[model samples]
Each structure stands twice: as C-alpha cells, then as structure tokens.
Target: MSSINAQRLTVLAGPSGVGKGSVKALIQQHYPWVWLSVSATTRSPRPGETDGVDYHFVSHERFEEMIAAGEFLEWASFSGNLYGTPRGPVERQLEAGLPALLEIDLQGARQVRVSMPEAQLVFLAPPSWEELVRRLTGRGTEDAATIERRLSAAREELTAEPEFDHTIVNVSVEQAATELVELLGSPVKAAH
Candidate 1:
C-alpha cells in the first residue's frame, strides 16, 4: 500500500449494541498490524474493564482540561459522559505509517469526520431492529432506564447510516471483522 493508504484512519461507528467492540477485538487478535486507538472517557469503568486497555478512564475535570488544551482529535458528550480520542497517539501511529482504527459512537465519529476529512467511516449495523433490542437488553450491564435511553439513541443512529462511507451488517462477528480489515486495506499478520 502507498504511504497515504497505510496511514489512512478508519472510524468504526454505529448504534449501541451493534457489537463494535466485538468486531474490534477480533481485529486486534487477528490483525496486529492495524493500530487501534483507545479513547479517554469520564465514565466509570465497567466490570472487567481495565484502565488503559478498555479506556483511559479519567475524571470530569481532567477530561475538561484535555478539551481546553486541544489534546483531543475528537470529543463528545454521550450518555451523560465525556469521551474523546487523544490526538497524540493517533498522530504518532499515522506518522509511523500504520493504519489506525477508532471504534467510537456516532457523535465521536461525526467529530472525527470534521477534524480528519480523510477518515473512512464505517457503520456497523445490526441484523435487525429486534436483534439490536435483544442485544442491548441481553447485555444485562445497564439498568432498564439506561437501556431505554440507548434504544432511543440507536433509532437516531440508524438514520445516520447514509452518512457513513460503508455499511457492515454485523450478522457474525468474524464476518464483520474480516470486512473491516478488508476496508482498512491492511493485510492480516496472523489469525488467532
């Protein structure tokens, strides 16, 4: 691939419960060449979530400080929490001629589009609305009120599908991961 293509940034985004994380995990395991950007968020860590691995969990004050210092490539308030992509790590990855992948929500994706026009946005959609609902509820991580809020947001996010450059229907995690890797134009280094 050309240097430009090697450094191309890809944003994976979609409604909640679309299995973006699962697809991302597969890519990380199978394609170690693709650099995935870990986001910083003010939200408290969920069960089994590590500090630097899953997210760089920070306090609200620190998140605000980052925003004021222009440290983020893109930041947004979602589900009453602040989440952002740190600009430094992504810049370093691109400088090293690596394809960078960002798995973020719809709001963060929009911000990335404006900040980095060259980014390729991929929408991960569920097989069906019913399946989406089931996935959201089945997680059993959040309470009923939170699930309802996510469902409402998912409805809006689904409408924004046309905004994305490509749509990957996540019928299977392995299939979706393969499709995303193909989109990035990155060769798989190993398969696990």
Candidate 2:
C-alpha cells in the first residue's frame, strides 16, 4: 500500500504462540521509539513477567471497575480471563506523533476496529497450522490444559486473519519484524 503516518495506531492481533512477543520484543529493541501499549489483564503473571510492564496485572474487581468506567479502548475475555487496552496511553502517544502499537487478541482487535476506525489492524501468522500447534506445545510453561485452551483460542483467532488489513507470516522473528516495519511505513494513513 499506502504509506503509514508516524502517528498511526497499529494493532498486532494473531494466534497465541505465533511468536508475537518475540517479534514485538525484537521490534522494540531495534526501534525503541515505537509506543508499545501494555495491556491490562486479570490473568496471573507468568514467570519472568512483570506486573505493569508485561501487563497491568489487576485484581478481577479492578478490571471490572475499569471496564465499567469505559477506560479501555477495547476489552475482551480470552481463555476465561479478561484483557484490555487502556484508552489514555495510546491516545497520548498518537497525539504526540508516535506510532502506537497494541498487541492484543482478535476480539479486542475487532473492538478497536469499531471504536477507532482509523487504527490499522495487522495479523501475524505462523507458517502453518501444524507449526502453530508445535510452537504452542513447545512453550512448555503452560500445563497441558492451559496449552490446549490456548491452541483452541489460536484456531479461532486465525480464522479472522482476513479481517485484518495485512498479515505477516512469522517464520523468522527478525525478518518478520523488518517486514512489519515496512508494512507500517507503506500505509500513509491509519485504517480500520
């Protein structure tokens, strides 16, 4: 496409275990200027993940309060837990002429599409469904039950790839990130 503006709100929504964190981390490391929106979640933290940095780990009550207050740009329940993007940070970043990035789930993405029609939706895909299953099982942090649930969720998310403006297949994290950077620059305007 079109060239993306510096203030575009870019969303990365895809199947879990498709290495989004890895790709996003690499992007941040290489391009520290990008505004990455940390999500607010009711899920417990995984090992090595911080409370506010990885996510704004909130009590279920706090999450509900935020939801009721309309603080989130979009919120969704995933795998029996809730996750949302706070409205303030992303708006401030966009206003400040920064490229704001939100790495969220598909339901949340759909919400953003409705609420912020200018936001550009990008879906990251694995090379294959088999590879996706392998990656999910390989994480090894989640128990079999949790892993299965995530995989099931992944299937649902993958079905919505066509809903996104573009998709990047994640074979190599660095290359994928580079391509993402290119895609981000190709569209000049924010999109629904």
Candidate 3:
C-alpha cells in the first residue's frame, strides 16, 4: 500500500458529552498504527492524565506564545481554557504519509476545515439530547454551572451537524471507532 497524504487526515469533533473520548480510546487500543494528534492545552491535567500522552499541558503564556508564533493549526478557548493542535507534528505525519486523526472541539474543527480544506471532518453525535444530558451529568466531575454551560454549548454544536462530511452517532464506542477508522480510509486492524 502507498502512503496517504493530507487528504487522509480526519478531524473527529462533536458536542461535549458525545463519547468522543471513549471512541478515541477504542481506536488507540485497537488501531495502533493510527497517529492521533495530542492537543496542547492551558488547562491543568486532570487526575491520571500524562503530560505528553493525554495532552501537552502548557502554561497560558506559552500557549499565547505558540499562537503568536503560528505554531497551532487551530486553537480555541473553551470553558476558560485554551486548547490547540500544534501544526508541526501534523505536517510531519502527513509528510510521512501516515493517516492522522485529530480529536478536537467544534471550533477547532471549523478552523481545520478552513486551514486544511482537504481534511475530513467527522461529527460524533449522541443518540439523543436526553442521553447527552445524562452522560454529562453522570460524569460528576464538573460543577452545576459548568454542566449548564456545556449543555448550552452542546445545543449549539448539535445544530452544526450538517457542516461535517460525516456524522457518526456514538451509540457504542466500539462501533463508532470502527466507523471513524473506515472514514479515514485505513484498514481496520485486529484488536490486540
């Protein structure tokens, strides 16, 4: 098989509680060959999150510096925190012909569409709005105010579904991961 180009880069985005992380985890576990871009964030690492693995935790000043230096492919401020994808690593992956996947927010996805028009934007939607509410509240990690803010953002995000090239309803993590991999035009690898 030949190497794929930037056209193979897939951006997975959806509402706050749509199981985007779960689907991403499944892909990472089963498809080891897929290059998933780790985003840089100004938010402090949550419990069990590694610096370079889960996210590239950076200081707010450093993130600003990166933005000023034109290092990020896309960046957005969400819930008072800045998150962005570094451009260099993504470019390197595409240059090497590896199919790269970016799990980002709706704003970041829109930025990617403008910056890299050939990239495929995939929206991972929840089965229903009620289910999405349940998932967000069930987490128990955020306060009530934060939850309300997320729900508001989710409502707006859901309306933007038509903007994406593909929509995968995340009823099941495994199934969603499989659909995402297929959309990337990469052969699914057997689960290890």
Candidate 4:
C-alpha cells in the first residue's frame, strides 16, 4: 500500500465515559492549529451545544441528502442516531496542511480506516470497568436505562481496541490529550 503525505488524519476513538470529550477539549484548547472535524448528526443537540460547533445539527432529510450525495468521509448510526464526518471540510483542512482529527466512535473509526487507509487510528481505553461505570454514572446525563445501554456499547468498543494502530489508556484526560498532541505532531509516512 502507498503511504500518505506527512499531513496525516488522526482518529481518537473510545467507549463512552472514557473521556473522549475531555481529550477533545484539551486538543482544542492547547493545540489550536490542529483541526478537528465537526460531525453532522441527525440527533437533537443537548442544552448548550451549538450548531456547527458540537455538531452540524441537521434534519434526517438533510443527513440522508448528504449521504446520497456521497458527501461524507464516513457515516454510521449509533444510539439510534445517524452521525457522519463531512467530506469537504476535512479535505479543505488537509489541503491547507493542517492535521485533521476526528473524535468519533469505534464504528465510525472503522469506516474511516476502510475509506482512508492513511488515517491513524488511536484507541482510548479506561483504567478499569469500575472506573468507567463511575464516570458514566457520575456524568448524570443518562438515566438508568440509557446508562446501561451505553455501558453495553462500551463493552463492545473495548473489545475492538486491538484493531487500532495505537492504544492509550485514558486515566487522565490531560495526559491522554498531551499524548494525542504528540501523535499529531509526528510526521506521517507515505506508506505505513
């Protein structure tokens, strides 16, 4: 297989409650130059999430339209909602010599791997299942049923860690994000 240019795309994927959001925030706060792709979702935004920031909140119709137009780099459905990475923005960022990072789920990461073999896939694991449970429950975003559902999904995601190129245990969000930035800084290989 041919290696890509030094401008690599990095994917940060982990189970729920594994601090993906915290790591993403750290990347945004500390590494302003690294561009994180904004995903489009058919799900409704939470209380404070703004359109085009947390996600490009679109109707189911619009999302289907984008899918039909082949405008997504990768798309997947999770937790009863559709999510996809927009193609145009990611290409624009990469064309401008910026590193593109996509913080998404394992399924989405897998899809990206198939489509863009050059993208670096990183898996973020929790210290323990108990710790994961504690974090998920403490977040208070989900009810018992929802928490259980997410935990189930987490289990599946954890099982697939070895499929990734690198695995980082997310015991501390700052530490994990720092490591992520380090990986981001590394030069990409044309053929890996």
Candidate with best TM-score = 3
Task: List, residue by residue over 1-192, the lDDT tens digit for candidate 3.
Answer: 233343467899999999998999989998887889999999999999999999999999999999999999999997699999999999898887778999998999999998898888899999999999999999999999999999999999999999998899998999999888877765434524
Local distance difference test, per candidate? 0.91, 0.86, 0.90, 0.87
lDDT of 2: 0.86
TM-score of every prediction relative to native: 0.89, 0.86, 0.90, 0.89
Model 4 Cα lDDT, one tens digit per residue, 1-192:
234333788899999999998999988887777788999999999999999999999999999999999999899887688999998998887787778899998888999998888899989999999999999999987799999998998998899998998888998988999778777773433312
Off by over 4 Å in 4: 1-6, 186-192
Listed per candidate, the RMSD to the true structure in angstroms reads 2.7, 4.1, 3.1, 4.3
Model 2 stretches with alpha carbons more than 4 Å out: 143-145, 186-192
Residue lDDT tens for model 1, 1-192: 223266778999999999999999999898888889999999999999999999999999999999999999899887699989999999898887778999998888999999999888999999999999999999989999999999999999999999998999999999999888888775444533
How does model 3 fare in lDDT? 0.90
lDDT of 2 by residue, 45-153 (tens): 9999998789999989999999899899999887688989999999998897778888887888999999898999999999999999999998778899998888888
Alpha carbon lDDT of residue 161, candidate 3?
Answer: 99
Better by lDDT, candidate 3 or 2: 3
Comparing 1 and 2 on TM-score, the stronger one: 1
Model 4's TM-score against the true structure? 0.89
